[model samples]
Target: MMKIGVIGISGGWSSEQLADAVEKKTGFRLIVDFENLLLDLDTGTVWSGGVDLSSLDALMVKKIGAQYSPALLDRLDILRFLQGKGVPVFSPPDRIMGVLNRLSCTITLRNGKIPMPPTIITENVDLGLKAVETYKEAVFKPMFSSKARGMEVISPGLGAREKIENFAKKHGMMYIQKKIDFGRQDLGIVFLGGRYLTTYARCARGDSWNTTIRSGGEYKPFDPSLELIALAQKAQSLFGLDFTCVDVAQTPDGPVVFEVSAFGGFRGIHMARGMNAADLYVTYIQEQLDKGLITY
Candidate 1:
């Protein structure tokens, strides 16, 4: 039997969902709340306490949460161990970190030649204020955030400048951008196995920016733009990601790249698209398993 670890922070909704999907689609059992496999570097043995990492074929990393500890070094060490061995880790660790940083992602989009709104990563209040003044609108977001959390929209007379400064002081630097004027519309494109599974939804009646479950934003299937398809493909290639959720804004100027999520919101996208996305992900894992790929 081949084992594939479905990882999250012990137990999270998304993790549970993915585990179920993998079991159903690929016949890989879920190992929740247990460290089934262990590697003794000194002894050069991989054991499941009783089992072994050699028994595992792949790993679906569903959640990579915020780590504010110096222990992040230890976390990276474990990731490197598993990956270096040969286990096919879905949404590989390096790509996950790459998509999490706002500034790095901006550079990625530019390098990939993807269309996006003007953006700046700065701690200087003057520059942030100036961008808002020039464009008459802008958005302030943490370098690492999810689900439209910690997102803000700036407009003239909205007292957004001070807000940006205060936010920066507390949360490191921010990614500020001239707000896209799309009139309450946004797009989320999920790419798995180098294919686009797109969805469209409004920003919830009065909301201008965020359209997440917390904000009561509903989802529906919609056609994707040629540009969107192209950008999504380019982004996946650049990240070398097996899966991602790319958010885009429909601005008056054009579609703007909002952000790319590595452990992107899989539940909602899977539910809304109803294209069996989880199964697709499991299929990828299954392929890795069938190939008998195991690092440990």
Candidate 2:
């Protein structure tokens, strides 16, 4: 029995399915809440819910929804400690943070010469307004959110300044992007362990955000263009993530990346394409174990 530690048990259909698959493959799986984990200083002991995390064969980060708080920093410290103790964490805390920080992703993609949406991150409201004017329309997204939550599309509008101020006040910085014209659909490509799993286009419901696939919105399975595939693969490598979904949008020029998600959910794809993300992930874990590529 391979003892594996998963972050949290997120209650959703896809998560449930994935959990079942992982359990069936590994036999023994442990649900760990990094916040609930404690570390002893002198003895160098790490315990969570009466289970010593150091004893686990492997640590898999799944549902670690932490923010920029002291507790979250402490959790990162614990993750580093686990790595120092020779326990393999599939997506280390730094890689996870890189994907979550919107600014970091933009810089990394831009530095790598990967095309993405024209983005502007600013602490000053004036610069933000300039970016909006430059693009004539912009989308403001939180640095640490997904599913299009806490996002507002700001064009030349009456309430644009208020929106910018409110966002700056709330998030301390404004992360804005030039909205792409995808004609209502944007590609969402999933990759696990550096291998492609599936690709689907997230279609908007009426005038909704193209990246979001939720109620009334839908996703359809399709073969992305060769350029799209390469872009997604390159982003997966640049982020150094074990599993991720690369969102891309096509303009007149070519396909531009929207954002890469480190903790993307598969409920939308499960409902639309009927492809199982959990099965792929668990299979990858098992393969690593079988090949002795990953160890405790």
Candidate 3:
């Protein structure tokens, strides 16, 4: 029997559905909170009170939740250990950090030769305002967050910087970037195995940047521009990830890299496309098992 391990058993609506769907599709029972199976480094024996995750055929670190302290963020370390021991982990732990943060995502896009809007991320409000002044159309967002929690557009002469500073003072620093004047719609490219699994776009009626869930932004299938497809593939390869959803915006300059969600949502995409992301996930896990890459 193929055993698969998943994280975040109790949180996240989409991941919960994905886990249940995975079991139905693959017939592989999932063990949640498998990070509790971590081994004591010096002893080289597994920890207590959880499934023997070391025996699972594959593992998926379902978008980890916010850890208030460093000690609470041990799931990634466990995943890395499993990977080092030849277990093929989904969205590899290192890659998780690579795509989760806005700054890291932008940096990766630049390093991978992907196109992106000019960006300015800082704590200084004056510098941020200057960037908005320079670009005339910019977006200010939280440095580390999901669900477009604090995403806002800054038009010319808008007194958004002061508001941003006030928010920043309460939160942390903000990462701001020039918003692309992309006409009409944006694309959400879900990729697996370094290739495009689905290429679709979403269009908002008016004043919308996010297009999948959380914003009531409606979507229709789209054929990605060759450039956007190529960039997405390059990013997947660079991260060496098993699955990723790369958000791209079409601008006059071409496709601009927006965000890369490592632990992306699936119910909306599945509901829209009538394809099961959970099934795809299971299939990928089995493929890894067949190759003898995953142990346990």
Candidate 4:
């Protein structure tokens, strides 16, 4: 039996689903929580619940943390260390790091000529206010966040400066983007091993400003055009993640990429398309291990 470990939150839906899939395939199940991880540099060992993670055949990262935070970067560094020790980690810590910070991800996408909403990133409250004024309406987002958490829509006038200032005080840097009229929906284009797998749309419910499930949104199956898939493929190729989801919005100008997810959502893919992404992902890992492609 292959001993495959999963690094994720214990009670997380996606994490548990992935562990179940791995157990079904390899007859071994271990969900390694970062909180319980003990990395001993002197011994070059990473222990979690008495299991040496470095001894696993392969490790999969379903979710690094329950929420997005800079602390998650430190967790990724631990994975990078494990990878250096020759444990095959899916998605590769380096690639995940590339898309972890919103600013870094945006810079990479812009450098690759991927179209995005008009944006500004700065620590200056004046500039943030100016951005809101310029766009009339802008969304202030944390550099490290998911599910629209800590995101605020600020329109010019009426305590706009105070809003930006308060956000900047908490986050240090503000990522403000011109709010695009995306018809209250956006697409999550999923890819596995750099190949297009499926597309799901998140439709905002009622008066929510963001199309996140936490914001009262629901996922639905969507069929994207060939051009849209090509665009998403080009965007995901920049990071070369083993599994990723590209958030894109179709605007009057065409499709513009929002961000390439570090850990794509399994629920959206499953609920919308009825596809078992965890099973497919585990199978992909097994194939890579069989091919000897994940050598240290």
Most accurate candidate by lDDT? 4
Model 2 clash count equals 0
Error of 2 at 140 (Å): 1.2
Evaluation by lDDT, superior candidate among 1 and 4: 4
Which lDDT tens digits does candidate 4 get at residues 1-296? Answer: 88889989898899999999999998999999999999999999999999999998889988999889999999999999999998999989988999999999999999999999999989999989989999999999999999988999999988999988899999998899999988989999999988999999999999888899988999999999999999999999999898999999999888899999968769999999999999999999999999998743
Q: For candidate 4, give the lDDT.
A: 0.93
Tens digit of per-residue lDDT, candidate 2, span 1-296: 88877765556444466667778887875667665778887777789889988887777776665343224545666777887887888777778777666788778888988888788889999899889989899999887666777788888778888888888998888888998777878878888888888888777787566546543568777788777788889987898788888888888878888778877747656766897777777778777767888532
Question: What ranking of all candidate models by lDDT puts the best one first?
Answer: 4, 2, 3, 1
Order by TM-score, highest first: 4, 2, 3, 1
Report the candidate with higher TM-score, 3 versus 4. 4
TM-score of 3: 0.84
Candidate 4: TM-score? Answer: 0.98
Over 1-296, each residue of candidate 3 has an lDDT whose tens digit, in order, gives 66666666555575676678667756765546543456767754444245555666667766566432234336677767767766567867877767766787788778888778888778787887787788887778776667667677776565667766776685566687887777777777888766688876667765666554567777677776677788777766667677788877877777777878777736546755877777787777777778865432
Q: Model 1, 212-245: lDDT tens per residue?
A: 7667777766688787778767766778677787
The residue pairs in collision within model 1 are 48-51, 85-295, 86-295, 87-295
TM-score of every candidate: 0.83, 0.90, 0.84, 0.98
